[model samples]
Target: MNSTLSNNPAVVIGIDLAKTHCDVVGYDKNQKIVLKLPRISKEKLLERLTNMPRATVLMEACGGSHSFIRKVKALGHDGRLVNPGDVKRIRCGHQKNNMLDAAYIAWAWYIPGISFVAPKTQAQQDLQSLQRIYQGYMKTRIEFGNRIHALLLEYGLSSPQTSRFIAEQLPEFIETHTKDLTPLAEEALLMLRDSWLEASEWEKKAGQKYDELVRANEDSKRLMTIPGIGPKCAGALLTHCGEASRFRDSRQFAASLGLVPRQNSTGDRDTLGHITKRGPKHPRSMLVQGASALMIMADRLEGALGEWVRKIKASGKKYGVKVCAIAAKLALFCDTKDPTRTVNKKPTSAVTKVSGIFG
Candidate 1:
């Protein structure tokens, strides 16, 4: 594999990565094909790249792509990642295949203004993994809880006294309902309760892991200094955004989180609507939740942040709109990579002074 393409080295390479094998397409400086290989084993591809001269490698971001990018970077080559959507827009053929995908990935190198994803560190990836696991468990638990509630409703049972009845007094609730319950209904309720408990246990384990990891991470601690940014939010943000250095400024960071407004403009006029709501979804949603909590306690806030909240409220936007705007500001403040960067002349004093509420 190494000797096969050592003669005509490429300036750009594209990889369409799959489970076991990957398709690699290389192009010279003039967009001319230098070497093309399909279904090359991952081991052979790396072995071949290890022997070749350093060049830029491009790929669509997906499963296994980040790990490969990490290896490519370590091999002293520029490893760039493109959005699969972006590659599809530039790909020359109407027909889609591995070769075409790989070729356009290389061609995208020459297409100016295409955004490339930065590869994350092992630590960031690990934090992200823990957060995702916790989210999954919590989501499952909620589903099970909802199923229990629906089943109870089917039996003419009144709504539980509390929203969290499943986690609190679910066993007692089931016991009391035994008189009204049929055999199958009781069995289904018992199964769902057990599933909910299992999910809860796993969620607790994952949460503890997050707490341990975030406490040890100085950047996570620093990020927690901002209002509405907690351990979960910090962990999720780091997982998705890597370091604040990846973003040039706070606006870029907010935009990356899809906090910025969606743009739809024509030649003579400009239009803006709701946020694009793109990028890492979990952290963005978490930030919004944080912002909502902060707004509820706005009276307790002081200084610039308090005033900023008041101004947004006075703007007469809908409640949801105000929440999203606040979330965007919160994201900008979270971008402490450049602490000097501020939003709308409001300072961090407004953010940090009152953030202890979340603690």
Candidate 2:
């Protein structure tokens, strides 16, 4: 490592980080690539960067980049994620290798209108870890449920497939048909029944664990008070929102989640497309599911908003399109905490307020 570049001269470093070795490139304010180094171990990399007085560091947002970003930031330097997509488009007259890629990121860091990723905090990372475990268990559980349904179909015993039905009815069906089933089939059925039970238990544990995390955070509790946001959604949002104050407005937060529509305009012609789906997926999925649940519950009661949603559905749009619209509005409303952001000015439905009822 060179100490000359480590001093207080303004420099931009683009790091191509890997598990063991990192490729680094340093550039001056004038965009001249002054130093290029081969792979260095993590300790050596940190020592070099820490020795440097201060510099803007750029790295792609990837698995290792998350912790590395935090580590670099702690050393009193700016660490930014250069979207791999944008970096992909900028290679010219140079070999496409780690060194060149790093150099490009350094150059891209200072570009106009480029947004930098907000580093997540330690607490946020822990929440994310819990969410990942929960998400994995839930996904596997869904798979297990599907397997049970498929197995039953082989026995000419098809039932309406659902998580609840699998949890409650599948075991009873297996027990009742024990005498008729072959020894091997009976064993398999019992195993699947136990698997479903395990999945259910894991799901419950995940929820309880997440609830504890959510309850501990006052901001998450405040978020839960909003419609269509539950413990899981609130916890995920609070965890993922690395600095809610970093966002100038709730609209920016919504846009970051890709909840906002895409726009296209050419010479007085304007076309708006679906959501960009550009940010953390867990929040978006949770928000959409919450909106769908609210919509379903609201439909059971005759209400102004439900009636309005019915009208929209009756207008020939698919039910999913309507659900997505509601979800987007729900996200916006929750993010802003401004009642005025609601798309419909009508009174809230009975079931619409059930989220608040949880309190």
Q: Rate the local accuracy (lDDT) of all candidates.
A: 0.80, 0.74
Count of backbone clashes, every candidate in sequence:
0, 0
Which of the numbered candidates is closest to the native, going by highest lDDT?
1
TM-score, prediction 2: 0.83
| Candidate 1 off by > 4 Å | 1-7, 161-164, 334-338, 341-359
What are the TM-scores, per candidate, against the unseen true structure? 0.90, 0.83
> How many backbone clashes are present in model 1?
0
Error of 1 at 109 (Å): 0.5
Candidate 2 residue-wise lDDT, 1-359, digit = tens: 43334333548888988888888888876766666667877788889788776888889877778889989999999888877777876665567887778778888876788877777777888898888888888887888878877777787777777777776776677777776666787678668878878987998898789789878887776676556678898887877677666676667777877788789889999998887888889888888898788766766534345566566656777676777777776655543344333334444523233222112
Looking at model 2, report the run of 10 residues with the lowest lDDT sum.
350-359
lDDT tens readout by residue for model 1, 241-301: 7645666766888899899999899998989899999897988998999889878877776
